[model samples]
Target: MQPEIQLSNSTTQLESTQNKVLRNTYMMLGLTMIPTVIGAYMGLNINFAFMAQHPILSLLGMLAVMFGMFMGIAANRNNALGVVLLLGVTFLLGLMLGPILQAALHFNNGAQLIGMAAGGTGAIFLTLSTIATVTKKDFSFLGKFLMVGLVMLILASLANAFFQVPVASLAISAIAIMLFAGYLLYDVSQIVHGGETNYVMATLAIYLDIYNIFVNLLNLLMALSGDRD
Candidate 1:
């Protein structure tokens, strides 16, 4: 009986910690969007592709973005500087997203499609996040497999850009949504299990997961719903 009581108390404490981390993570995630929007607006207005014209420059730009992402994740363990850098990185991401946004806006129903995509993305995030919290399932086992799959997805996308394979694009988008939704579950469960304590880092992981999911979903939706006329 005494051991059972102790076990119950420990469970309660863990739950309390999980709730706190989840709350803080969400608060920070919400805050990070301000800079992202500002960056997107600036990038759009300036027509900043960071890789628009020169192929070599575009490759270099991608490398730089990857470096920034690595630094943001690694630095997150130590200081608030990580949080600042994460926002900066996200702003750059928004800039990168601008091209897609621009393309989406070109369609007659583009604005409506964007709204629909955003709504769909929000629904998936909320549903998956709630499931992760309620079930307390550990999805970390998916990390390595998903990473490998993402690499393949990237390679396939580059190949398709050259080959212009419509089927390949559909396949990539489907895989991306699945992978990132899994990523969302893993990220949230980390907070729930106290595997992640820093709100900035937590927010970064979840935000990236959410962003990828939304972008891929939007791509799929646009392909299907876009009116080329």
Candidate 2:
């Protein structure tokens, strides 16, 4: 009886910790959007002609900066600095969106398509997160598969950067949407199942998932439904 009681208490405590982490992650995730929006707005006014002329170099430089920031955030995950670094990363990512946003805004219904993409991404995230939280299903099994898919996706994207194949670009965008949706589920499930104990890290993972989903979804919409002026 004593052992059983102790085990029950431990389980309850674990669940409570997980709940707190999830709540904090949601709050931090919300806060991240403020900086992201600000950065994106600023990006719209900035010139990116250098990137246009050196696409591959620009891609490599962006990736290097992002990777370094990710490492910094992870290293400081237990402290307030992690939160700050995460926001910085998001801001940088938002700035990176300038090129795509510029392209979209060239179309007559660009703003409309952007709204729809945001709505779709929100719907997908909410649905997957709800399913994960309510069902309490372990999605750790997806870790390896998702990693494999991500590598493949990266390879394809790099190839297309050189090939400049329009259809392949569309395909990559479509695949990215689906892949990131799966990541949303897996990330939320990690929090629910206590697989991710740090709220900052969890928020970062989920945030990235949502960001990728929105970017890809917007790309798809722009490709398929954008109206030219």
Candidate 3:
């Protein structure tokens, strides 16, 4: 009976901890949208002549942004500044997505396709997140696999970007959607199971997953739906 009582208490504490982590992750994830939108607007409206002239600049910019993201994660345990920096990093990512948006906007059905992609991606994310919470299964093992897949995908994308391979582009978009969907599930499960305690880090991971899904979905939709007139 004493052992049973202690087991019940431990279960209750775990549940309480899970609740806090989930709530904080969701709240921080919602807050990240504000800066993302602001950065997108800035990207769409603002033009950088230097960036236009030097494609390498974009590559270097990506490297710098990734460095900042790693730093933010490393600092998340000690300070609130990590949260602020994470938001700023997301804003930078939004800016990077500007050119893609610019290209999509040129299509006759661009706006409609973008809206559909956004809705579809959101629905998938919600479904995956719900599954993670309901099942409470640990998906942390996906981390290494996801990293390897992403690296391969990035290399393929860079090659296709220069080579202009239509099939490659389609493959990347499809793989990206699936990969990020898995990521959504894994990240949410971490929060629900008390594996991820820091809201800032949780938000950053989930935000990147969602953002990649949207980008890939939008690209896929554009390739399929966009009419070249």
Candidate 2 per-residue C-alpha lDDT over 1-229 given as tens digits, one digit per residue, 9 for 90 to 100 = 9999999999999999999999999999999999889888888999999999988889999999999999999999998899889999999988888888888899999999889988998899889999999998998899999999999999999899888999999999999988988899899999999899999999999999999999988998999999995
lDDT per residue as tens, model 1, 142-228? 778888988988788777766777878888998999988988988898888888877777888898888888788889888999987
Best of the candidates, TM-score: 2
Candidate 2, poorest ten consecutive residues by summed lDDT: 93-102
Model 3: per-residue lDDT, tens digit, 1-229?
Answer: 9999999999999899888878988888888888888888788876756666765656667787788676766677458778778878888887877877877888988778878988998899889998888877788888789889889887887777567779788999999999888888888888887778777778888998999999999999888889768
Q: Regarding TM-score, does 1 or 2 come out ahead?
A: 2
Task: Give the top-scoring candidate (lDDT).
Answer: 2
Q: After superposition, how far is residue 169 of candidate 1 from its true place, in Å?
A: 2.0
* Candidate lDDT (C-alpha), each: 0.81, 0.92, 0.83
Query: Over 4 Å off in model 1, which ranges?
Result: 1-10, 48-60
* Candidates' RMSD to native: 2.4, 0.7, 1.9
Off by over 4 Å in 3: 48-57
Clashing pairs in 2: none
Candidate 2, backbone clash total: 0
